[model samples]
Target: MAVAVAVAALTLVPLAYVLVSVVAVGPAEAARLLWRPRVGELLRNTVGLTVAGCVASAVIGTGAAWLVERTTLPGRRLWTMLMAAPLAVPAFVNSYGWVSVTSAVEGFAGAVLITTLSYFPLVYLPVAAVLRGMDPAFEDMSRALGNGPWRTFFRVVLPQLRPAVLGGTMLVGLHLLAEFGALQSLRFPTFTTAIYDQFESTFNGPAATMLAGVLVLSCLLLLVAELRFVGRARVARVGAGVARAAVPHPLGSALPVTVLGMAALAVLALGVPLGSLAYWLVVGSSTAFPLGMLAAATATSIGLGAAGAVATCVLAVPVAWLSLRRPGLVSRVLERSTYIAGSLPGVVVALSLVTLSIAYLPTVYQTTALLVAAYAVLFMPRAMVSLRSALAQVPPEFDDTARVLGARPAGVLWRVTLPLVVRGLGAGAALVFLAVVTELTATLLLAPIGTTTLATEFWSNTYGLAYGAAAPYALLMIVISAPAAYLLTRESRRTVPGR
Candidate 1:
């Protein structure tokens, strides 16, 4: 418990840095910067994009999950994988694909389109899993009560899906709030992009810090909203009856339409970016792939990702254990505190670390260790969520069994609980690793001066208007994220929390 609290504090370094920096600037300076017309525009854009993106994602994700899970869409299994598989594609890569094909996706519409396509999987996977495991008894009862499918769905199905819906929506909001790469590429000036622009153009000036403080405030607002919407609702079953399987809804005359819709969505979300990468890979005129530099960047990204994955999983253990084993105010606070830093853009986290390190730990500034720490902090929630799911699956009987066999608590954890949750640990670690590898803002700001990563290299090449040169790195990122995303989909089917 103490360990979890300490880790939570460590994860909050970004928030602490922002608070201290903003306070040091004095209210007059903050008002001068954040109270301006430009600040208001940024806020409007940020809030608008977040709300619109979440709505679109909720609709698309929930719709896709329902179709795949409830309807007799042919090859629903394959379609299910296709729908969720977009998780592997980074939003920036999706933007690069669309822009490479056509420049029409600019400003608000483009930002929402690309983000919804990229992040809807955040909603889809969980909802689909819940739909898969959902008990049919309730729906049957609704039918017996003479409620039509539509009415039953709206009143019964949707209400029961609240936990998954709200959880997924919260993820969408957070991703949109923290999103940098996609928004930047799409030319939407959210708080995150503005903060990055300020830091890049001004080099850690007070203006950048002030902008970041506002972004942090935005993140805090998001956390508060999530807490209210996703309160501690009980979703567990009270009885021991085996759950009946859901009856698949027949498509009938809608079969061709269902197939077309599913095909179009899959092609748009998964096919376009992959097709774009392949096109740039083989046919571009400026195709001067830097094999050696690509290799070096890949090596750096993998090293940092692997290290960050381990560190994040280690930090998540106590928090997840306490949340599951000793559920209470402290555990929930420790668990929830990790979400704030994660929702701020990587630039905010990176700049916060940059300020903290330069002010008090200059020697560690720009070090690989510092970069990994930032990754762990930013993605700790991913690890903790997966860890808690894994922990929940490890029944108490195993612990009791081991203890009765004269095993110590530590022995029970290692010998029994660990074995049961090894898959979940892998799931959590893989998620953190993939997130770290694709991570841009923190790595860009906190990495060692000479270090280059796939994300950074891709950004550099693209920044220089060399799309062909950046293709390999983008392709490599998708390749790495593919299995991790698949692992996550598999893990989502486990003994997840209620609904």
Candidate 2:
């Protein structure tokens, strides 16, 4: 119980500090800031990009998932891996690739394109999982009743896919809200970019906090809407019946067109960015790699990522256990609280921490602890989601069985529940660790004066047009993040039922 409380406290402190400092300036100041032209523009851009990105991701992700999971498409297994591999390529990397290919691709359109490419996988993974798990009986019955492929897909499969689609869409939306590097690189202005600008140009913590408060409120409203509209139903298949795969509808003359289109998208999203990175690496190698600087940045990134991952996983365990086993208003609230902080842009969280630190804990200001706190706030949801999935697999009956055998609650948790869920916990930690390694906006703002991570190093070198110098850091980030991405994809595939 004490451990749980401490984890919860750790997760909440940064958020609380941010909120209190924002509100400390009072409502009038916040209101005045909201009325400013800059705020209005930021709001418009943020909402527009989020809406556009979410819609595009849903369409693309769902389509890809359907093709890979339900179709008799050739190379299905390979396609599944290719579909998800884009997640390893960060949004900024994708943006850099696109920009390298064409100078014109560096605005709103570029932001949408890069973000969609990077994020659509979020939707694809879950949708594919749910589709794979779906019993084909419904579709088989529909066909027998004379419904065409399109009609059956709409009337039968899609309705059943609502929960998964919505869940994936929610993840995409949250990511869009928090997105920074891609948007900044694409020369788009959103609340996140505005917050970063305010932080960078002038250390206006109160104003930045004010904007962050509004950003949080905006995210809360979206969360409420998603919960209300998306519903709270599980989409898993029940029973031990052998569910056959859905019959793949032949595209006939359209097959060539469909295949080509999908292939082109995959190439554009995954291939182009990678090609650009390779080019830069080759060019940069001519000038020699900055071995020492690279080593220091790599070490710093790994250390912080490891620390944040462990911290986030530890904090997420209690929240997951509470929500699953001791679920109630409080548990639910605690669970949702993490999301509130998680969904905000890293800039917002970083600035909020900066404000609180400068005013109250100046001693720890610009320290690693403060940076890790920002990471915990920004990436906790990934840990929570993985933990929740792990907890779900550990049946409540197992706990009851342990109690019946005379084991105490703590002992049962340690000996039975913990063992069962530790894999999931480790997977969750890996997810957070990878995310932290590539994280940019927050690290830029919160990292100590001399501290450098791969992300900051890449950003600096790239901004200065030192493509060769930037290549090594970018390469290192990709290499470090690759294993984690693979683990996540493997775990997701294994746990996702049929597919």
Instruction: List the RMSD of every prediction in angstroms.
Output: 2.8, 3.2
Of candidate 1, the 10-residue stretch with the lowest lDDT total is: 490-499
Residue 454 C-alpha lDDT in model 1 = 91
lDDT of 1 by residue, 188-295 (tens): 898888878877786756787787777777777876776677655444444555466788998899989978988999999989899998999898776776779878
lDDT of 2 at 367: 94
Query: What clash pairs does model 1 have?
Result: none
lDDT of 2 by residue, 180-260 (tens): 788877888887777777878996878877777777887787767765776544444445555665677666777777778
**Model 2 C-alpha lDDT versus the unseen true structure:** 0.77
lDDT of 1 at 163: 63
TM-score of 2: 0.88
